[model samples]
Target: MNCESIRNQFSSYLDGELASEQSRRVERHLSDCQGCHAQWLELQQLDARLQGLAVPQDLESRIVAAVGAETDAEQQAQPAPPPRGYRKQVVAAVIGLAAMIGLLAVWLRPNMPPVDVPPPLAAVVVRSIGNVQVRAPDAEGWSDVDGPHHALPRGSRIKTPQRGGCEVETATDAQLRLDANTEMVVHGSSHMQVLRGQVWCQAAPQQPLTLGTRPPADTAAVPDVFVCPAASEMQVRVDQHQAAEVGTEPVRKAWQLPLLALPGSDQGELSSLVETLLANVGHSKMQFMNADQIRALGPRGAIPLLMYVREPSSSQQPAVRRQAMQLAAEVADDTALTMLDELLADPDPQIRRLAEATVERLSVGSAR
Candidate 1:
């Protein structure tokens, strides 16, 4: 590749777009072309510098003023409006239809960023009549839960009841690791509750742990505390005043129902646990809401997660959104489609990509 050609294709080459033949040619040229190499390095440095420049204040206002001035000047230069003509109306209608089709194409394009797609509604399990508990970190060498009573080293899987549940993560020595689908209720200073999920806890005295209603929960049941002394001994109880349990086997089994008393309250806890698991699973939560939920999650919850869906880092948004999207497909309706479209406007790029994928998934599933 010559200098000019290489320069023109520099971005594509940097992005690994060149085919084998072109790639070999570029490699050969780079080996002998010090000047081109220098230019490439300069371009990379320029990119870095440009990235470092922060958005200036009032950028929107400045751009708006410039665009408005241009438009106003153009309008002033134009003569008076011509009389209404059927031909002009027909042309305008055709243009409008074309624009609408173009927008639909953009919405349907998988490669393009998502825009105007609505988010799915949160899933509601009508009745979880039967109960079950399981653990995650199912991948061998990743989980610590071997059985009901055993605790593994850090990063071990705690069992969760639901299929798409959360996992326990251990961050420090005293604090035990929590895995997906795990729930714990703090009975008091003495005993901790495990309602029907998995948790990986270190048996340490100075590190007493309790599971109960946490943040976002209006009330908590009698807190349950899990005690593991330095002796590697463990106990579960509603409070320090009572012995919820003692010994390895019983304690392990009892951990399953830490939140037994607060089943409904466990929803918020479960949601929080899911959020935690998603973060550990290398995801971030972005807020994409329709016109309605935006008001509720905002006014009531005092939190807003609204954004454009096509911006980078949307993937890091809450994994729960994915679950919601699936649920929307199961309950396909105009409302669901509208919600998906609204989410398409989410500012997060990863979210936008996911929203698009979810739309396709729902569509395919419906067709089947």
Candidate 2:
């Protein structure tokens, strides 16, 4: 036989399905042609590899069960008719009596108490203060929250007034701090939304948590403290004891503030640096400045930037406003507090909301 015809039947020949004459022809061709012999060796290798594969543990049982159930169903659906005879009527009567007895037994069965399915565990409010309210997913409006250790369900919303604040412990052992005038919605054990206000979160190292202003578009977990700001729906990751401001843009070094790293330097040099940084806030090259720069500036350096940001005419950008608010928080002092108060009456609703939250945080810090 030609080489092409012999090669096509190699698989069948390997499986012993080829006729005796065809198998002999293929073997003779392999022996004569070195190329065909190499091809035959490859086919043998492939067969060996396939034969060495292990079947899944449950595969055989699952296949048998599926096929058996299908056969039984088909058989039951088309049971053979009994031979036409006088016994047909008797069989019908017997079947009718058996069905009636089954129905009666079912009707007389005693009713058992319903199973008590536990509610899904969510975050617990470990601590709270004045004006803190919660609205469950089922509830329409806000209601006074129970004092402390209140377990909230998914879809529940917690709101803190101007003088209110709270701490929450999530199921994954993560800690969340909600500042005053903040509203947050619980999505699940590891997910939540910051509708308005500031939320400082530290997730467990092993099981990171997720925080977003809206439902997360991705399901990846983040292993960092997330700072969610009001107005702009974005999450900013910050280190512990560090602060950051999240705006419309992605997280950058400029938004982060390393309070501990600030140098105790002269105020004049810091002022010039702050001015330089603010001037470059919107520029592509200087879109952000690191916490070290801001910390070096200290509260004094942050003051001028705050004023420039709060100015009604200075580039009404959300990024500028958010950075200003964050810088104000870092420089939490009388002057910053006064600016935040002025921001309370700011025309932008988001800026006003953020200002209220910042004021609450400053008040808390001052009290401490």
Which predicted model would earn the best TM-score? 2
Assess candidate 2 and give its TM-score to the true structure.
0.31
User: Worst 10-residue stretch by lDDT in candidate 2?
Assistant: 252-261
Q: For candidate 2, give the lDDT of residue 115.
A: 41
Which ranges of candidate 1 are over 4 A from the true structure? 1-8, 15-17, 31-35, 76-368
TM-score of each: 0.20, 0.31
Question: Candidate 2 lDDT, tens digit per residue, 1-368?
Answer: 78888889977876668765665566556545656665765665455434434444665455556555665686688897444563445445544554556546545777945544334557888777676888877778888877667888767889888876777777757766676677888865556667666766665533334465532335343222232221222433322223334433322223112211234323563554454455444232114666556656666655566666565545557676666656555655665777678878877786787778878877887788
Each candidate's lDDT (Cα)?
A: 0.40, 0.59
Clashes of each: 77, 1
**All-Cα superposition RMSD per candidate:** 29.0, 26.4
The superposed Cα distance between candidate 2 and the true structure at residue 91, in angstroms, equals 43
